[model samples]
Target: MFEALARFAVRFRWLIVVAWVAGVAGAVVGLPSLSSVIQTNNAQFLSASAPSRQAADLAAPFQGASPAATAIIVASRTDGPLTAADDAAFSRVLLAAATITDVTSVRDQGTSADGQAHRALIVTVPNGPGNAPNARLVTAVRDTFAAASAPAGLTFHLTGPLAQTADADTASTQTGDNIRKFTLLFVIVLLFVVYRSLLAPLVTLIPPVLALLLAGPVIGQAGQAGLPVSPAIQQLLVVLLLGAGTDYGLFLVFRMREEIRRGRQPREALIAAMGRVGESITFSAITVIAALACLAAASFGLYRGLGPGLAIALAVMLLAALTLLPALLAIAGRALFWPTRPAAGQQSIGMWGRIAAGAIRRPIPVLVAGVLLFGGLTAGLNGFTTSGFTSSSPATASDSAAGSAVVAIHFPSPTSNGEILLFRFADPVWHNPDALQQAHQRLLTAAPVSALTGPLNPNGTTITAADITRLYASLGPTGSLPPTPPAGITPSLYQTYRATAQFISPDGRTARFDAIPAAGPAGSRAAIDAIPTLRTTVADIATAVAATDSGVAGVDATAYDIYTTSTNDLARLIPIVLLVIAILLAVLLRSLIAPIYLIVTVGLSYLAALGFASIVFVHHGHSDGLNFIIPILLFIFAMALGEDYNILLMARVREEAHRYPLHEALTRAVARTGGTITAAGLILAGTFTVLAIAGNNTQAHQLGYTVAFAVVLDTFFVRTLLVPASAVLLGRYNWWPSTLSRTRTTDTPPTSPQHGPPSPPHARRARL
Candidate 1:
């Protein structure tokens, strides 16, 4: 099959080149403008039934009149009560901001508990579903706010989703620039070392660069088509395409060169190399695609959005490797290795070869050592803890150390619980005389409430006239409270409330309960589990509210709904991915035994990677835990890449076994392909390590370190030592009941034979 492919590629090399050119041109012409949004859509991030989503739905109507951005009011006074002059100046600043095109309203002003610190203004911007807060508007607001001269001894601080998103975007852009610059340098230097030829390394990098170019436009179109792409997907695509794409390209070229060294013509050598390596490449690509596709099953939109893009990128890379790469090699001919000639009578026994030799000499020792090393890394899993959105933001340095510090000092808790609970009043009952009063009573009495407001509506039928109206009004035009709600109701009521209930329907048919976990940061773990407890409380409140003849229906049960749903989806998807990988390996290897061993080795490598990541980021790296999404993402990438090495080593062993005994074949295969596999592994590892330079944020750092370490271990220990050792141990059984054994037996040479070429008499005598 590979020979035929190689022949076709050589015959139609120009056609392939032309097709690529046309494809690139078409993609460029058809590319859509890239636009992205950074909003915390609870349903998108969490689960459909999450309290946050429920609350959002209930609050929807009220929110329509409110600003999308949170307003942070800072008031620092040097002395007595704030003067009228201060109030007048602040009001002018806020009112001026309200006139901006995107600004919805600005309000909330009062005095703080200390009297010396007075409450200032909060400006709200319109944020509607599907409509992101305008960056220009946000910047305008910030600039306007900053320019406002506060009366002497007053300072202001701004912190909200809008500000955070802007900061994160800026940080990500800078990080991307750094990554692009550093990665270019890294790839160039590393490729040179591996190929030992500047031209060869440059040639090797082409496929990946082309793949990335193609992937970008395609992903842009996907995004426009409503395929929920997260901005982070772009970064992942770049890293994977470069790393995995280069690895594949190098593997094929190296094998082709090896074949050429054995005296075959360039065309025949390319054919033989493809024939031997093509299936492995296809299988490896399938593994990666399948793993990424599994993410589609994730409950979070982020994962679901990323899955298709990654799968498409991997598939394109695979096709390029099989078709375009072969064509390129065929065209280059003997000069592909220019400036360096194939050494005469030279037997290359590189570092990997020596390592394999040692492993072969002491298989058990090698296996034991490898297992123990991996086991120790896995132990770090104990310290792992999950973090929130702030932790994921690239709002600070390469590692986001400064951002993390800021969060710790000023916002030691989850920035906002992002949890919501919804209530819907049965239609007919909403008009009932007692409906509004009863609902307010239930909300006030709810177990989670630290404070309560509303039942302020006199009519009690219309949503705007209900108790929620007073609450919204108190939050002011910016949706934030004054230091204290006018005397009778302290402004702290909104902030202290476990759940802020609001009516959404104009007819008073629906209401929302927004809740913050009372347990705080130290309580996240317990809170994550106790969602059921919160749900029960919510249910009880709903029942009480409904009894008023208002027919209030529970829209959301608890914050736990989001967490549990995602956790469940992750649990289900992981096994499905593993099963798919195993089946693919089985079919590719055409042997159940080989597939089982391969899958086990890959699984162990994944666990080891996760464990090691946990140690560095959680224990030594001092992070709360690896990013919540890291395990799944790592599993997919690691397993896919691991399969690449498995295919390379196993294919070589199978081919060599056709001539030599199983033990000797294993040794020969390891020696011959070890260098290529090692080089490929190191290149892939180095590409991931670039993330370690991401600074502050541990997500990139942990992921980069884990993958890089896993690849190294896989190449050196698992592929080089364990695989060859096991293959040697398996002996003839490795071939099973196949014709491979039959062909070997039938092709055996006679005991005695005359040489084709004449040798010196003395040399012939010495050999005899």
Candidate 2:
């Protein structure tokens, strides 16, 4: 099948090339921009049934109090408490801030309880989703604050959800360009080092570039078809295509060059090379696609789109590898390696050959040592901690992070992020003082609650029913009270009742409270961990209040949901992914045993990769933990990619074993495919390393580093040593239940270098 396809590709090379170009161009022109359709909000990526989503639904009708965009301005005294003069300056800054365009309303949240340290201003503005503040508004707010006069000790910082969204978006955008440039440079440099030719690297680079150009349209179309593509996944498409495309291209091109060196004509070499290596490339692509497609079963919306999105990317890469890459090699001919013609018999299998030979000689030791090494690496799993969807400290040098630092130091709340708990009773309770006090106490004492604000009088003070009634009556139906207080009502009591109105529904049955965490940043482990306790306490409190419904909904809750869903997705999808790979391997190898062991080796490689990443990023780089998304992504990329090399080596082993004894076949297959697999691994690893360094987002960096490290481990250790050794030990059983295992060796001896090409029947029969 591959021989026929290769012939068609080379026979009408120009037509094949032209068709690919036209298809790619048409797709590029027809598809929409991926960014336009990408979802940046974490909430949008949650499953409809996620607890956070449920809470959001319950609170949606009552969410108008918090503006879509807000700029939180925190001011502090550098030396001491704010003096009278500094307070005057703060007032002027607040007034100036209000006049800025798009500024809806500005409120002074008041001074810190200590009175010696901090004061804050909250400014609301019209903005887009994801809390992305309007740039113009941000600039205006900052400028207004800057112009204000203040005492020597006073300092101001600007940070909030709005500023964070803007900074994060900028970092991701800038990082995308950096990743592209770095990947291209790495590919060129590595290919030059490997092939030792100027033309070869350039030729090898075309398929990946073509694949990248083709991906935009494919992703756009998928998005149009209702697939939810996140900005993160959109960025990932390019990296995967470049990395995987280069791998397949390397496999085919190196094999073609080897055939040419063996005295075949360029066209014959191309066809023969494709015929030989094509199965590996095809099977590897299928393995990757299968693993990714399993993500479709993910409960999280983020992962559901990811599985199919990556699968589509791998498919395009496979097509380019088979068709366009062959056409390019056919056209380039021997000149593809120009300026560096090689001497005869100079083929270098290098250390891989040595490793394969050692494995064949001492299979048990090699197998045992490999298992021990893998087990050692898996030990790092104990240190693994889920960070959920928490945002890290801003990666970019932005004002938002700077402002958040000052806020954390000076504000009453320990962190800048806040959580809101919502409750609704079967009975109206907002007017009932006892019910309000009971609910407030429940939230106040909840675990991780450092501070709590309730729906009744904000200050801890006493007020009778008669005082409240007079205040309400005086306030009238419009929520506006007479300027003069009623004779019996205190002014403070009237002001408190007015401020509490926003927390209650007009019907007075539902109420909301804001809670601040005891410690940690918004998305940090501490804050996310506090959510369950908060929810349980709130639920019990709601029952005590005879409320019909209650839930915690805020930044912490969202982060918690993201973690829970990600964990659930991992649990459910991993078994399915392994099963899919096993099934695919079984069908391809025609041996149940080979598939079983191959998957085991891949699994070990995956754990080792994660352990290695943890060592580097956690122990050395001093990260809190591996990013939440990295584990599953590592399993998917490492195992599937490890299988890529496994399929290439084992498929060749299966082919050669038919003619040669098991041990000889294993050694020869290792020697023959070693250089190409190594080259592919180097290129793919280099690309991911480039991404690790250039990826601007925190998670991207983590993913890049993790995958790059794992690919190298899988390539150098698992594929090179463990797989070949185990296969040698397994012998003919490697092809159990298949004709290849049962078939007898032919009477003809193995072909020599002087024997020329074997008969087509022999080649075909060997592959079967």
Candidate 3:
């Protein structure tokens, strides 16, 4: 089948090349920009049934107060309590800030209790679903603050949801060009070094570049059809195409060179090479694609989004590796390796032949050493922990994080983040308004909740919830109170009553309040984990208030849902990924035992990589713990990519074992494919290292480093030392349940690998 495909590709080489070029051009000109579709808000990525989303639905009428695009400007006098003059500067800044485009309103929330700070709310209509408007508004607000005159001690910090998103967006955008340039540059240099030719690297690079260009728009279309596109996902596609896709190119190219050296002309060599390694490359890509496609089963919207887009990318890469790559090689011919030409006749497999022979001879000790080394690393899993979605200090620092710190000191809330608590009763709550107090009191003492503010305590002090109904009856509706205080109502009491309207629905059946979460960053793992207990408290509060419904909504609530869903996604989907990959291996190798042990080796590599990363990021690094997303990503990439090498080496082993003795075939296979796999691993690892240095956040660092390390470990240790030794020990069982197992192999490879004369395959027998 591969031989037929190779013939078609080479026969229609120009047509294939032209079609790939046109496809890339069409994607660039016709499709939506990848950035245009990137998801901005975390909550937007949640399922409609998520608790925070449900809370958002119940609070829809209060959207005016709970604007999606909102920020807080915290003004404080660093040296001491804020004075009247400092307050005047804040007033000016607010007035100037209110003039920014998309800004709906700006209102002072009043001074802090200690008089050291003040916060003002800036609300804006979301111009679009992403960060462009938010970033523009943030910049305008910062400029407004910068242009203001105040005491040198006076400072203004723009913090909260809007500012944080913009800062993160900007950080990711800054790293985009570097991720591409360094990834490409690294791959070219590595290929050039390995092939020892000027043109070979360029020829090898075309498929990955074309794959990268075409995959983005395809994923964006998937986003249009209803998945989420993130800047990180786009960047990951670039790295994956260059790193993993190019590996298939190396496999075919190296094999073609070997075929040419065995007396096949350029066209014939290309055909023979593609025919031989095509199944290996095909299975290698399928392994990656299968693992990624399994992400669709994940309940987390982010993982669901990731699974499809990345799977599409791997598919594009596979098609290019199998079709366009060989076509390009077919056109370029032997000149692709200019300045060096293949010496005709069978040649030695060099140093790796001796190493393979030694490991094959001492299979027991070699396998034991490999297991013990990785086993020690696997134990580092004990140190593994989670830091949650976002950390206070990420690899990419933002001004908003710094501002939040100052805001914490100025306005010492018990919780670092706040949640919106909503209650709806069977009847109008104004009729038995004291239930508002019952709910508020219950929440104030709740361990993970504090500083409850609602209809009963609007302005940080208790008020009669009935006074709210009475004031509205006397003045106006809950949302529209009299412009001024009338007879007998003191100004402070009138102000409190006006503040109370937002908490109580006009119909009076529902109520809303700001329930400050317990003291920790909203994105912390502990904060996410604490959500279940907090929800229990809310349920208990609902029962005490006798309300029909209750829930908490905010960043913490959304993060909790995503965190739990991601974990569930792994447990439910990982087994499916393994089963699918094992099935592919069994079909490719035609042996059930091979798939079982192969998956076991890949699993060990996955754990060792993650364990080492845990030691670096969780145990020793500045991180509170490794980000929760790292382990899942490591497993998929390692299992899939680790199998890439496994498939290639095993395919070569199976091919050679057809004619040579089992031990000789094992040596020849390792010696033959060693350099290509090594070069492939280096190129793949270098691209990931580029991401670790160039990506925008700490999670990227952990993810990049872990995958890169796994690739290297697979290249040098598992594929080279462990698998070969184990194969030698297994003997004929390596091909059990297949015709290859029963075949008697008398012939062997050349003995003096570096200097032996080429011998006919059926007649030669090699001695170790």
Candidate 4:
């Protein structure tokens, strides 16, 4: 079937090229803008059932009037203490902040204890990381503060949730672009080095480039259609298409070159190459798509969209490999490998060939040694820990980082990245002293709250009806405070009451508090690890106190949810991928037993890869550990891609076994497919390795290094040695329950190396 398609491609190569051009153009024209749909808010994508989401939903009504984004402004002096002039300048800066468009409110918290810095919170409505309003507000706040005519050596800095998120968005974009550029450079250089022919490298480059052009827009459009796509997922999509597409393209080209070197006509070589490797490529693509598609079962929205999004792009890459790539091969003919020709009937016994011959001859020893090697590596798994999603990148290196440093020095509480709890009561807590005191005491269970602020009265332990009466009277009976407090009320008391109003809903039933966890930053494992206990304790207390509702909402909660969801996804998806791929292999090979061992070796390869990654990143490279998502993502790619080579080689072995003994078939299959499989693995691994160039992007670096190393194991050890060795040891039983296993043990003379059709070659003398 593939032969006929290849023949048609050779005859209609131009038409195929034109079709791809048209397809790319159409993709460009129809691609929807994803920016509007792109979501940077990780919390927004959480399942509705998540505690954070539930809390957000409950708080929506009360939060309707709250600022969409808030900025923490810190003003510092180089001189000893802030002078009267500096204080006056800060007041002017605050006044300027309130006058900016979209500015909802600006409040000066107080001067730092050192008296060199003062802090304030600039709140603005309708603001977000990506929106123009937020961007303008952020810029306006910085500019307005910098414009303050303070004494010499004074400086202004902005650092808060809004500023950090905006900076993160910018950094992510820059890093992703850097990764792409580095990947392209790596592809071009590595292909040239491997192929040794400039023309071959160029031909090798086309398919993946086309795959990106064709798949990127579709994926973006899918994201725009409300499919849950995250920045992390989008980056992975590009890397997957390029790496896998190139691997497929290289596999076919190498096979075709081998056929051509044996002296077949270029057209016949193309047909034969397609007929020989096409099924393996098809199966490979399907396995990958199936593995990724398993992510759909993930309860996390991040995984739900990631699965389908990557699958769609991979399917496009597979289509191009089968159709567009084949046409290119047909059009280029022998010229694709121009300047690099093989002498007629002369075969090259490369490193892979030597390894294959060694394994085929010493099956049991090789198999045992390989297993032991992988087992030793797998031991590292015991020490492995997931590096939870966290940003160690300090803003944009200079201004952003410097500003953050200033904030940390003057206003350390904001820098804690702690927890925020939203509490809703049957009545205004400030109007019920008992409920208010009980709630505060309940929160004390999760003690060491370094800082706590909410709607309660002074000392944060009580609220009395008299206090409420004073609050309203001091505020002129309206929600807004008067220019001066009513008779008998102090200015400090009125200011405190006005500030407390920000945390309470007008309906008097909901309130919010910012609490600093003593553990650490929300991204820290300690912080996330505390969430369940904290939530349970908080919930129990809330119930005991009769608070209408209570839930934790913050970075800490989100991190905990992500960690839990990822663990759940790994547990669920791994078995499904294995079962599905094992079934696919069984059908493809038409043998039940062969699929089982193939899967076993694939799993071993993944473990070996992970072990190696942990050693490099944790023990040696000084990284925290593998990224939390690495194990699952690596498992899917390694198993699916590792099977790619197994199926390729074993299917050929199955074909040869029809004509020769099982042992002889194994030897011949290894000899024939060794180069192509190794090359394909190398290309794929190299592409992922290039992701290490993503500066400060630990997730990218972790994935890049892990996948690259894992693919090497898949390509060199598992595909080349372990699999074939296991097959040779199994002998006829390798094809269990099949008629062929019962049929033959005769010594047959294998076909000599020559320009002939796809047939088994005699076991050659080991080059080693």
Candidate 5:
């Protein structure tokens, strides 16, 4: 099968190249916009099973009037402490903003205690087209306020839920673009360095570029086919295709060059090279695809979408590597090695042969050294903390950070990082105001709450519980209260009475309030840790009040659920990926023993990489902790892509072992393939290094660096040293239960009592 494909590619090189180019161009021109698919994917990051999704469903109706929809604008006074002029400007702006659609309630939260800042709140209807709020609406509000004239010496900032989402999205998009651009540039330079010929690098790069162009459209179409696709898949595709495709190119090209030096012409050499190495590349791509497919079992919609989307990308790359890359190599031929052309003769087994000889001769020392090195790095796991995944807030460099600072200044209440708490009952609580007050009092004492805001504490201070009942009587029946204040009631008091309609449902069966966690912002490590305890207290309050249903919603609750789901996914998905890849290894190598140890080496490599990342990004670096997704991503890429080298190296070893004794075969195999693995590892590592440098965001940097470091470790250490040494120690059992294992004996084997005979005279002559 491999020889057939190679022959067709060599015979029809021009046609293959043109067809691939046209196919990629078609995908680029005709497919759905990448951004549209990303937006759709972003809206579904949480599955329907998540508590946040359920909470959003339960409180959908109350969302319109909820203060949780509110935005805050802080007008900082530069000339002096804020005065009446700032207040007047604040009121004028507040009224103008109120006219904006979905702006439910606009209030001057008023001057800060320090008297240096003034704040006004603008509340919009929280519900948008999908799961998230309308971030575009925040842009509109922000632009309106920025366009409006403010008091002299006042600088203003617009910030709230949707504003935050908008800012974060902007920063992420910019950084993602930078990563793609830099990765492309870096890969070109790296390939040029690796090949030394100008045209050679370009020829090598065409396959991966074509694969990348085609992947986006395939993923978009997959989304249309009802496959879950993550918005983040596009960012990751750049890393995988460029890295893996180039590795495949180097695999075939290096061997082709060697064959050319061994007296074969360009076309014949490439065909021969493909015949030898094609199976390795095929199995490598299949291993990565299988590993990624395991993510389909994840409970988090984020991971579930990521699995098949990435798998689709690898599949496209596999096709290009197998077909287009072979054609390019066939055409480029000996001229592809222009600056350092090889003359026709047999190639030498030089540097790697000597190194491999030492490993086979002194396997114990090499194996022990590899183990100690990896073990030392893995000890960095001591600092690993599963605090949570990344947050939607922009980085410190973004405008959102400026807005948060303003919030910290003027809106310095304990509830600054709070959640929206809601309770539903079969009966209305307005008539039974005491039950409402009782629930509130219990939350303050029993829950993690530092403060609570609801109908009973409308102005952030207590209002008598009995007055709530009396006030409802004066305001008339449910949903019938006059918009205007009646006689004997103050206008401010009337607004409070009207607000009760918002805090408690107009139908009067449900109530919503705000509760500030004692720990801090929902994304903060401490706050994330405290959510389980808070939920238990909420349940206690639910049972005591006899509420039919209740929930804690907003950022904190959603983050807690996401973290829990990711934790479970890591636990479940890791074993599934390991089993699937182990099976693939077993079938490819025809050895159960080889599969077990191969998987162990890969696991060790992954864990060491993950721990090293924690040391870089968490323990010593400025980041609070490793992003929860980074470990899972690091593990997948390390284990899957790392196996590419494993397969290539081991397959060569097995082939050589068929023709020679075990120790000599291992040594020769390493010498022949070592240069290829080194070049491939360097190119793959370069792409990820560009990712690390250009990622710009904390989580992106962590992921990029971790994977790059892992590739380097596997290239210089595990693949070069650990795997070969362990293989020598395992001996013939490496191909257990297969004909190779039954018939192929080691050079020095006599452990079995029945196997102690000398060879016949003809057999001895055949060995010579």
Candidate 6:
């Protein structure tokens, strides 16, 4: 198949070149008019179907040109009561905000107990689905607030989801721009260094650039077809394409050069190179694509969105490497290696040659040394901790740091917080006006509830509206509210609240109860821990609600559904991905033992990557921990990438083993292939290192460093030392029962006699 492809590309190289140029130009011309829809993972910002989409749907009925913008109002004072003058000034500021063009409704303005501090209002601004936040309106509000003076000794703080989102968007854009600039510069320099020729590096970089340009249209079309594309996909695509794409290009070029050195014409060399390396490239690409595709198993829209996009990018780069690259090489001919010809009669001998020869001489010692080194690094895995998504943002940044400061001062922890809770009742009995009023009063007195609305229905059952008002409410005039709720409602009411809190079916048989912790929304260890308690509370409420009538079913009984589902998903999906990768490796290499060792090495590399990142970003970097997705993502990249190296090195070893005995073959194979693998590894690693330059979030930084470190370690240590050492020790067993052999056959070139090259100078001197 690769031979046929090479033939077509060499036969019609110009057509391939023209097609690429046209496609890239067309995409560039078309992508600019594209929509700039800023999406986020926040459930409140999307609909229930997908977190962002569901949030949008829920906010639809609020009546606006756009969804309302959320705002937090904080009132603080030194000593006196919050006077009428202060209230009037604050109200005027909010009222002035309503006059802005996109302004729709402002809700929930009120004073707190003791009158020393209060929450005056929440500002809701009109926003369309997928629209950028109304920054103009927010600016106007800020200006209005700044212009208004509070009563003497009073101060106010204003912020909310909209404000934070707007700030994040601006920061992310700036950070992305900076990242791109630095990444481009770094790639140029790094590639130049590796290839040692400006033209070769330029040629090497083209496929990745082409892959990225093509990916944009593909992703856009997928989005149009209703596939979710996360906001982060664009940035990730750059890293993914450059990392994998460069590796593919390097493999093809290295093999082509080797073929050229073996007395083949340029066209014949290109075809031979593709024929030899194409299968391995395809296998490696498939493994990576499959690994990324596994992310679709996640319930979270974020993962689902990224999975297919990354898969598509990998497939595209693979296709280009197989087809477009050969065509380009055919056209360039030997010029692909311009300014530096292969040295006359000289051969490349890499570190692997020395290591492999030493290992074969002392296999046990080498094997033991490798085990100790890997084991020592693996020990760091014990310190690993899962990080929250929001924690990816730099804590020192204005929005993130300021937000953290506010939460620490006014609440418990950020992760333990909930923004919105919806409830349903099982029976019409509690929907009665009086019963509903009682339920509302009960909710108001519940431990987690800060404010409760008047009952809207007249049944014995109804959904209660409780705002986690304390989240936005300021410190009391004296500083901090008592931890416990004041006594008023009965134990039955508390029990009923808990029972009805579960997200129950619409039938009067189920009820839902919800609580907003003092912290903000999203995942955290604290959030994970608090969920069971919240579920228990809801169960208690459901039991009480059920007592009202035999027909009543506690509908809202599953408050921990999202958390439980996500955790269960991670456990199930991770193993499946690993198993699938192992199977692919086993099949491609045709060796069970080799696959096992390769998988283990890759796994250890992944663990080391994660451990190193955690230490740098969490224990030392002062992040709470590595992001929850970091470990899984590292697994996919590391395993897939590690497989790329494995295939390259193992394929060379198999080829060499066919011509020589086990020990000599291992040494010669490592010598010939090590330089190519090292160059490929360096280029791929350099591409991923660009992520650390992304300043908008810590996740990118951690991901960049983790992947780069893993690639470097895999190339230098695992591939060079561990892999060759094991191959030597395994001997003929490495190929299993395959008919292929390590012993030289009649068809093989002579090892010591007169095949082609002249005898050494020492032999000539002896003859003289």
| Candidate 2 per-residue C-alpha lDDT over 264-381 given as tens digits, one digit per residue, 9 for 90 to 100 | 7878888999998998899999999999999988877778888788898888889888888888888998888888764334454555556677787888999999989889988877
**Which has the greatest lDDT?**
3
Kindly give the stretch of ten consecutive residues in candidate 2 with the minimal lDDT sum.
746-755
**Which pairs of residues collide in model 4?**
none
Per-residue lDDT tens digits of candidate 6, residues 279-303? 8889889998998899888776566
As for TM-score, the candidate ahead, 5 or 6, is: 5
lDDT of 2 at 563: 86
Model 5 residue 476 CA deviation in Å: 7.3
Better of 2 and 4 by TM-score: 4
Query: Which pairs of residues collide in model 5?
Result: none
Per-residue alpha-carbon lDDT of candidate 1 for residues 276-314, written as tens digits (9 for 90 to 100)? 888878888888898888888877776787787789888
Model 4 Cα lDDT, one tens digit per residue, 407-448: 566543532355767777887655665766666655655663
Question: 16-50 in candidate 3: lDDT tens per residue?
Answer: 99999999999989986666566656566677888
Global lDDT of model 6: 0.60
Give per-model TM-scores. Answer: 0.78, 0.84, 0.88, 0.87, 0.87, 0.75
lDDT of each: 0.61, 0.73, 0.79, 0.72, 0.74, 0.60
**Candidate 3 Cα misplacement greater than 4 A, ranges:** 63-159, 346-348, 390-416, 426-431, 455-470, 474-508, 516-522, 746-758, 761-768
- Higher-ranked by lDDT: 2 or 6: 2
After superposing all C-alphas onto the true structure, candidate 1 shows an RMSD in angstroms of 7.1
Error of 3 at 491 (Å): 5.1
TM-score for predicted model 2 compared with the true structure: 0.84
Winner on TM-score (2 vs 5): 5
TM-score, model 6 to reference: 0.75
